[model samples]
Target: MTQLTQNNGQIKNNYCVIDLETTGLDNLTDAIIEIAVIKFDLDGISETYQSFVNPGREIPPFISDLTGIFDKDVLVAPEFNSIIPKLKEFIGDSILIGHNVGFDVGFLREFGFNFEGTIFDTLDLSYVIHPTQLDYSLTGLSLF
Candidate 1:
């Protein structure tokens, strides 16, 4: 994994902010059950994409309760592969930005998605720029 520190490494267009809620936190053992993408084109136009997927595995009751995404809700929904094209379109040439975002990128890599360009990790930047803060979670940052 290469850290994109050079000025040349920054993305020049198509910025995207992505978030996912999964059945489990473990990247290897879990799958994305829901995803939300906020896309911003170079011209400052923005769009949004979201989907709920039926992970073949059963979701823990606790997670289902928290997300309100029961098995029945996604039983007939499209799988990740079905939505890859739209995702690719939404992510075109954009730097992916998210809070604690590596797992999402890792999962995309595991699924054979070729993600090039830069990644601006809000969590990492927040930690570095705001070292006095005690929490870096999305909710935590929002409260700051």
Candidate 2:
């Protein structure tokens, strides 16, 4: 584990960043259509994994517009089940980090990817790092 300075103090960390593009906001009803995960050491992205998942449903128009991932794009792609083994291997013993991690974690949990590692939400972290900033979105943080 690597020690990263947390708000309280230094924390031992084994970090991986995850970002999932889903069909919608409701985890109970929506599904993941694209997944991106990258393992990071102090240097940076040492390993990466990404895939388009077939959600078994139409990619909603707005979602397609936003993601540029239409139904046709994933028609022949493997679904979530096939992706799990590799994902588990890549994420072993690593803390998860993301811009809004809860949303990704919720969707992933619903699909049975039981990740029992520490989760660090950058949005939450931003509150401690840039407390006075008006926007905490990734783009906003980038502009700082």
Model 1 alpha-carbon miss at residue 125, Å: 1.0
Residue 102 shift from truth in candidate 2, angstroms: 0.6
lDDT of 1 at 56: 81
Off by over 4 Å in 2: 5-13
Q: Find the candidate with the highest lDDT and give its number.
A: 2
Candidate 1: the clashing residue pairs are none
Tell me the deviation in Å of residue 117 in model 1: 2.2
- List model 1 lDDT by residue over 28-134, tens digit each: 77888888889776555478898998788788999998888988888888888788888987788777888878888877766556678677788889989889999
lDDT of 2 by residue, 1-144 (tens): 446654555564458889999999999999999999988887777899999999999999999999999999899989998899999999997778898899999998999898887788989989999989998888889999
Least accurate stretch of 10 residues (summed lDDT) in model 1?
1-10
